[model samples]
Target: MFRGEHIGELVGNPGPARDAFPIEADTYERLDDEFYAGRIETLTASEQDLLLATAACTYPPLETADIRQRSAKSDGNINVLMGRLTEQGVLYRVQKGQYEYTAPKFHEHLIRRTGSLPR
Candidate 1:
């Protein structure tokens, strides 16, 4: 899991700065697609539903309680599901009992795939 500080370092420091950074657009896209597919494949039906519900949230980095309510799941179920999602690299802990998607665009991706909007 990437910490906030690590993300800051990546953006703030460009090692061996150059006029133009090399961008392997195709490779990056392929890898991203594969990652998305792989994560999706590992999820159970209920897990997938929970993920979609989380994605539908307008405000993010939600607390466990918020996610549980949104998904209409019990506390214990939400805890387990969140633990699994975090392990799968689909979500990241922002702080204790708070989490957000690992990728900024992941929520949008889920929304598109599930055809679900924030309630």
Candidate 2:
């Protein structure tokens, strides 16, 4: 038994497996400020509408149908708009389970521009 224990010690510890969880900050502030400024130039009126709509931040398992019922058209048009805003860094996705909105700047702008009460 002692010799077996020594042999096991020579080898590596065999314990439960361990996994790594990585967190990444995806801010774009490091890029030339001018570049981002130029790229984010005033959003179009249509884009603004879409942003506000998506900024509503619906969760998953809560069908897009529910979102459409609350706001503007929920057709493929809205789907495309959501994808575009997400790509622009205006939106952040939380992949744990539910889909919540993470667009503070965009949401604030929408509120100020429309002077609407929080939903």
TM-score of each: 0.63, 0.44
lDDT of each: 0.73, 0.46
Query: Number of the top candidate by lDDT?
Result: 1
lDDT tens digits, residues 86-105, model 1? 99888888988888888766
Candidate 1, which ten residues in sequence have the lowest lDDT sum?
16-25
> Per model, how many backbone clashes are there?
0, 0
By summed lDDT, the worst window of 10 consecutive residues in model 2 runs over 17-26
Error of 2 at 108 (Å): 3.1
Name every residue pair that clashes in candidate 2: none
Poorly placed runs, candidate 1 (over 4 Å): 1-35
Off by over 4 Å in 2: 1-42, 54-66, 96-105
List CA RMSD, all candidates: 9.2, 13.3
Question: Quick one: best TM-score, which candidate?
Answer: 1
